[model samples]
Target: ESNRIESINQSIQKKQGVAGCHYFSESVISPNFNVRITLNPDRERKCSRAVLRLAQQFPGDAGAMAPFFLNYLLIAPGESFFMAANEPHAYVAGEIIECMACSDNVVRAGLTPKFKDVNNLVDMLTYSMGGPNIDGGAYSMDNADVIRYSPPCPEFEVMILTVEPGKQSTFKNPGVPVIMIILEGSGAFDGKLCRPGRSYYWPANTDDLIFTVDSSKRGALKVAMAHKNLHLDRPTAINREDFGGASSSNHLNYPTSPRLPYMGLGGGSTPVNEDRRILSVGSKDYAEQGLPSL
Candidate 1:
């Protein structure tokens, strides 16, 4: 016990500590509303949604932003470098469906106050180049219904979906799990309906899910999706485990923080979990190591 206390004291002894640390999937990321933004475009602006932050290991203080938010962000499909890091990011006023490595370790700099370790936050962040800059607006698809954007990250990918009234879109998860967010009009999946503000998750091991738009209006459905892809050689399960129902109708009730083993103030330091069977890739037994399948 004396040794442990000494170590803890050493860890926080300096105003600015170590030069660096890496993020692993072992961390936990609890959801917290760091800030809020409202848009009013009618008076030169309309009502826009509130911005929310997601990170791997959020130090949860004001100083954390100095290192993490110091960089800019740009997201696209197939292009997914930002998601791989443990920096705190905001989903500014737009609904996007996101699915990741089944880990939530956020190291924040300008968001919450869960763990205000400024020294680690500054050291762990990547001061290199900013985020991915692929714009789907540059490409014109003649055959594909969905416009896929490739950011640069390998752990995740995104798709911008546009469906007309009475029409539908189909995607096969293969094994990787998927998350969908409604960006425009109303739509329904399986049987549950979603509008401009709702979100849903399809378990990693699930099969292809169907999305249908309301036939009452033209272009009634627009959705953005974030999903895991097959990049690493490791095998993962494709079983569709329900995220289960919300503990409360409020989004605040869900667990947004990543789990343990990856809990810390810094970001992008955890190792990939050998037991991750949440998102299926190619093989039936796609474990990083060989663990009993979930």
Candidate 2:
């Protein structure tokens, strides 16, 4: 934690830690919001969306200048970055695979007809001047194919797994529950065709899984997974049988904080495709992992 973060949290520890990560699938034309954005519109606004504009579309709120101070960046396909709590950002354009904690307590800075708590928002923002680097985004784990993105909050982390066509890759379970989505290409998972936009659930401590990317796709198969932050930064392959097979009853390193609304807050310009897909896990699994029921 940096002094800046500590200072921000000190004002309100568990108040509104809203953070997330994004993996760009298409080369963004403009405004990949934060990667967060805030009050300052220091430079010329390059991108304008149907929702927000420095010219006119901005709501008459106090911070309406942005649709201005809010930061914007262009991201190439396959690049990603983390958005810490309180950082202001918006994806003004392009499609992105975002993995964020499911929280209803989002503080919209602007670009929406919804409530804009500009006063509270002003207090929480880091106001860290300058735009972020597009090149310096998510990092690779022990497996280069897996682009690892673990944000500051403990709510969740994300993984982008890519496999080339006709090439087989094996991925071992990390002894934790994970929800996956196929971003591109095609494959088979237990008789189900895993193709773009398809999702799956993998149980904890499952056996080594193998994938053979379909040759007909002519492109790499990409999958994005949202899983518990199981202290897996540089993860290595693991076999469940070798550990004697008691994969359940796992707990986190620290006492789980109250899964309240986001510590920091952000919302998209348009409300339609807000990626608010929340899948319900079984109560039995929650009990085993010390997780609360959704």
Candidate 3:
């Protein structure tokens, strides 16, 4: 692996206008070698092909390249992947609906012009080898209509909810703010219209939110919801069984909680219960009102 990396670096350095030893360390090496390559379809395609060719030539050395050494996964619509922190990965193609933590502490290794924190990335990785483990980090809820993608962290949880046409689903709030996006068909969220290309945010402690797909819609109404896991006071047996047992720090034992609901396309209605208060970005006096931001 080191030999292949060294050879690739040397070749990059010898290129007339390239200034860096690494292929993706400088823009001149391939003009589109920087981080921008991840966003440009043409550049990404060329880079993927180049990486595949290199991998084929030196199969033994390909492991060291980490993420970029592998070919892209052609993820079809409705299918998705979970990427945790410190995991080396890159998105090569297609549109995706990403639901992640609010923080932006990403550590990039290559395929971008962004700062490559090589040492930090190396120190943070789990170093597990082999192809992508699709089943390693995923778990499903008892309700077949919902699937939870729980990463080994207590701060966030992602759930995919499917409401069949003419059917409905109810979610009890987990007492945390939530962000949701509609992925397929049309539905009524808490009696409000929801459709593709739209997102909604619901404040913490909102009452049970109901969702019903329009019977006229051709397929089920699919939505991706993300929120913090605030109800981890106890761990379940299933949580302990995941990832070959819970981590020493208990990061993997995220206790199941009632899923939260995010507002959809239409004006949010105030909870009829006079005691319950909901705050949103659209609140009339949001700027002047003194409410803790989620």
- Alpha carbon lDDT of each predicted model: 0.38, 0.44, 0.43
Off by over 4 Å in 2: 1-54, 59-64, 130-144, 230-294
Q: Is candidate 1 or candidate 2 better by lDDT?
A: 2
Comparison by lDDT, 2 against 3, better one = 2
lDDT of 2: 0.44
TM-score of each: 0.43, 0.58, 0.53
lDDT of 3 at 259: 23
List candidate 3 stretches off by more than 4 Å: 1-84, 113-130, 136-142, 230-294
Top model by lDDT, which number? 2
Stretches > 4 Å off in candidate 1: 1-100, 111-114, 130-134, 137-143, 189-193, 201-210, 230-294
| Residue-wise C-alpha lDDT for candidate 2, range 1-294, written one tens digit per residue | 685575444334312321111111113312443322333232222222311342244423222233223333334455444444555555544466666667565666545667756555656555433223222134454566776555444556677778898776767787888988887788765556688877888999888667777777688888877887654453221111122211111110111122211111122342211223221111111111111100
Better of 1 and 3 by lDDT: 3
lDDT of 1 by residue, 2-64 (tens): 855753453343213212222212122122223322222222111111112224334432322
Tens digits of per-residue lDDT, candidate 3, 1-294, equal 985575455334323111122333322333332333365354344434444443343332212132232223333333333343434444432345555555536655443434555555445543322222132122345456776655444666567788999898887776888888887788898868988878999888888788998788898887877787432342111221133321122001111222211111111111111111111111011111110000
Shift in Å, residue 246, candidate 1:
48
Candidate 2 at residue 6, lDDT?
54
